[model samples]
Target chain A: MKGAEIFVQSLLREGVDTIFGHPGGAILPINDALYDSPIRHILTRHEQGAVHMAEGYARATGRPGVVLVTSGPGGTNVVTGLTNAFMDSTPIVVFTGQVPTPVIGNDAFQEADIVGITRSCTKHNYLVKDVRDLARIIKEAFYIARTGRPGPVLVDIPKDVSMSECEFVYPESVHLRGYKPTIVGHAGQIRRAAEMIAQAQRPVIYAGGGVIHAGASEELRTLAELTVIPVTCTLMGLGGFPGVHELWLGMLGMHGTVAANMAMNDADLVIAIGARFDDRVTGNLEEFCVGAKFIHIDIDPSSIGKNVRVDLPIVGDAKHCLQRLLQELRSIDKDWKAAHADWLAQIAAWQAKYPLRYHQEPEGELLPQFVCEQIYEVTQGEAIITTEVGQHQMWAAQYYHFMRPRQFITSGGLGTMGFGFPAAIGAQVAYPDALVIDIAGDGSFQMTMQELATAVQYDLPVIVAILNNHSLGMVRQWQQFFYGGRYADSSLEVSPDYVKLAEAFGAVGLRATRPEEVRPVLEKAIRLRRPTVIDFVVKTDENVFPMIPAGGSIKDMLLA
Target chain B: MPTANDEIQRHIFGLLVENKVGVLGRITGLFSARGFNIDCLSVAETEDPTVSRITLVTAGDSRILEQVQKQLNKLIDVIKVMDLSEEPHIARELVLIKVNAGAETREEVFRIASIFRGKIVDVTPKTYTLEVTGDEDKIRAVINLLKPLGIREMVRTGTIAIARGQRVL
Candidate 1:
């Protein structure tokens, strides 16, 4: 068998049914091989779209999403998507074609050092030197991507390697000395952690994206119920704890809710579960948690004490460690309550005082929060919700009542600006049956706006709700708050007509300015059985409240 | 931060560079071009056909030291840069240590190292080598404590470290 054929065969063995990619000269051999292969390749208009589609697919289904692209710009285009996958911890395998081995460093046509370009972003990468390494490298790439802290892996294959003949032998077992995953928790450490949890007076659980990635939501729910400790999540940790649950305190960060932030600040003992204390979460590190004794439990050992110093660090899987803690806490101490009456009461007052309110005196524009709530109510947290970065992304994280883990997929860590539309395409492709919505801002929607063609060509019914305010509203909001209302390059006045853009890409477009028009249009889009974009002309000057001012504590929130 | 009396140690590394356009730039650019501190680097043709060797060295710890090898291997032109520390065979270093004395304590200083089997490689009537060998750590410790006693001049042959057991780079 030829090397390209062998690569295809290995993918089939791994049960990869769909691949998103764009064609180019360097990858003609692989594309030629793909023509006869059983695997279906969805041609995206842009290489960036292909990667996002793969990301969406991976998030929707619990499988590694795959993408393929040609050399130079095609390879470079996948960078943003790879970075997004890296930040969000999504499993994606990106295959990029390189120039022929004979002319690799000769400044060959359509040639770029993809492996070097994507080194920092990718979990791991391989540049196939020979045809014999093809099957083994592809297999290893998949294994690396799907295993421990799942992220994107890149495999750059030279055109010669793709065209060369080789025996198809996919490795059943691959070993790398440097890469070792610690699956089980150390017994002694677990016992010490449990002891610390038991001794705490006022304890709070801070969960992160790892909880969802580990598929430990049920364990988290059980643990929260058993302990009666309030659980707050990071941006990546949304949907890990059902938002409607009494124990859940919603997302905690710069724009986190009042109660969640209060719970974090007030607690004497903070049990950080599978979360790295990102700068966004810990606004001012010095005054963060005055007297809280931290017990950080994470699978990646390097994460512990890397950000927040831990008194007792437990490096292990969240589910396993939680289960061990449960076993250790057989004897109950429900009567031993550390006093948080004053603090909890204050938080309750805040919740009651500054609850998210929409315009009662309607100026005719549909409130973003209402749209998010209605979507959540209609979908009942069953459909996967992906979002572009900005106000809408934060609002979705805040308002959507996500019941299942991995249901709310948005760019969290890197906060890549234009991740929504193509990511939604990927999500729909991953979950062909479920209704997927790409909740995006007007500005973010225009960035990767070319992905509309991918959705239409693939017949992926991804409902994109463009929360259009006709500006780069997130920056504008920030400018209004911190930059003396000097709106510097935040306007989207020269944006292409989105309606015509969607139509041009062969998708239906709906516009909604009023509250009455939103639900009906959304319903129509959901029922249309084709790709649809809903332009929500929300209040132009609307801001995401409860923002932690620059270098300010979460306590210094500006509540609306 | 090197002391005024302390000398800098330079180690030479042989790298096999592939014959490709910008390969040299990719290799050297990794040093001067980026933040990685490179003391001294010299590249030239090697014995093997279609290959060139790059000699460079830096100082750090043995703990998590494999990263140096791994990162270098990732570069397209760099075939390998083996630390000569792994090669067996006794290697010698030339060091000049100048101790402080005013004739009263000068003989006392010369008396101490002679009994410990150290030779006075160079002398200015107020200083001597007490030439010794082991590794950088052993050399550094003696130099540090001696500085309080008065060290005027110091020179170390960087380090040409070789492995104890039989091995070749």
Candidate 2:
């Protein structure tokens, strides 16, 4: 069989129903091979868009998303997306077309040392020098991407290798020499953690993106209720537990709710599941949750005590470890709600005192928070929401009370500016009937506005709610507090008319300049059932509040 | 130790990594990316062909040292990381120094080399290339003694380390 034919067949064997890619000089043969293939190919406007789409697909589904792009510029363009996936641990397989073997070092037209460029960003990568190794490498790449702390993996194929004829044999299983990830928790560690949880009077379940990735939301909810533990989540873990539950203490971190951060600081025990102690989530590591004894459960062995010291660490998949934790607790047989009523009352008081709130100011400026709140209400908190980074992202985290796992997708770790729109397109592709919206700031939306064309071309009904603040609100907010209001280059002076841009792509465009118009416009966009862009002219100086200043402890949060 | 703040301590680490292309780049680039310092580093293929042992000397207290070790383990190419500072280990370095003796200081240089258990690898009209092997402190002492002899050129292979007898990592 020809190499290109083998590539398509291998993808089919791996059950890859969709691929996001862009055409280029080196990858033309593979593109030709995909012509008659059953797989749906979404051609993105740029290589970066393709990778982000692939990432969105991966995060939504547990399966790895595939990408095909040419070498050099096309390969380099996917670096940011790869880094984003690496940090967030999304499973994606990027296949970059390389120059022929003889011309590899000679810098042929689209030649780039892709494996060299992406080495740091990818979990594993390959340059297939032989066609005989192509199928095996593809199988390995998928296995690496989707297993044990899932992440982006790259495979750079030389053009000649793709065109070379060889017998096609796909490996049924992969056995990587240096890679064996822990799948089951240590029984002793899980018992010890249960003992700690049983004895604690005030405990908090700090869930993260890993819970969603593991599809362990059921286990998480059961454990939280059984232990009578208040649940707070990292931004990445927003939908891992029901946000509107009585025990839910909103998103916890730098921009976390007052109730959540305070509860975290005051808790006697913190049960962290599937979340790393990233600095953003823990403002001052030395002073973060100093009063709490920690129980950390994660699949990555390295994340156990990387940031904050852990008392009991379980290295395994969240689902399996969480099940073990529940079993251990049951074996112990302790009534937690009977013991922690006062602690629950204190949390309730804090929540009531300063909930995630923003004034609508109906006749005045269209506050970004109000827009997010209206979206939450209109969608009944069921929409799969993705957000571009900055103020809009934080507001979405604050306002949208996500009730299910894998529904709140954003660039939590890398904080990529242009992630949400492409990610929303991927989510829309995966869940065609479900509402998929990208909550974007004007500054962030412009970073990947070209993706609107891709959404239009694919007929992806992904709604983009552009919170059209005139300046970079998040940076400007920091400048207001720390840098003495000297905005510097953070002020995004020249901006495109987003509604017109969407209209130009043969999509619906709407505007909401008033608080009252916010809901109606979102309703109109959501009803339009097309790739719609809503230009929400928001208050220029509206800042996301309840912020823990950089290097400041969560205890020292500045509430506005 | 309980009350005092974190003061600088020299740390040694042993890392086993995949012996393949770009392993060195990943390791070295990691240090530069994080603005970490490598006081000395050495790498060589181990008895196992698939893996290479890298010994790195860095100056930092416990917190920074722990951070660096964790970061190194995060790299996919790195197989295992061991902090040799906590273990009883033997460290060695080989340094070659060419000093301009000019026939006047030749005898004294030779005497210093003998005290340090060094060997003369090369000889020129006004120079003697003295080769020495020892741990960091002994190597530092030899260099100090050779300073007065007008050392012209010097090069040192960085530190390589292993656990003490009956200890394995």
In the range A430-541, model 1's lDDT, one tens digit per residue, is 7788899988998888788878877888798999888888889889999998899999999988877777778888999888888777778878988897999888888788
Worst 10 residues of 1 chain B by lDDT: B1-10
TM-score for each of the candidates: 0.81, 0.94
lDDT tens string, model 2, A50-71? 8888988888877898999988
lDDT of 1 by residue, B64-118 (tens): 1233444455453455567654454444444567787657867766765565446
Give candidate 2 regions above 4 Å deviation: A483-494, B1-7, B166-169
Worst window of 10 by summed lDDT in candidate 1 chain A: A335-344
Model 1 error, position A313 (Å): 1.4
Q: lDDT (CA) for every model shown?
A: 0.78, 0.89
DockQ of each: 0.07, 0.28
The pairs that clash in candidate 1 are A53-A426, A56-A427, A57-A426, B9-B158, B13-B55, B15-B53, B15-B54, B87-B163
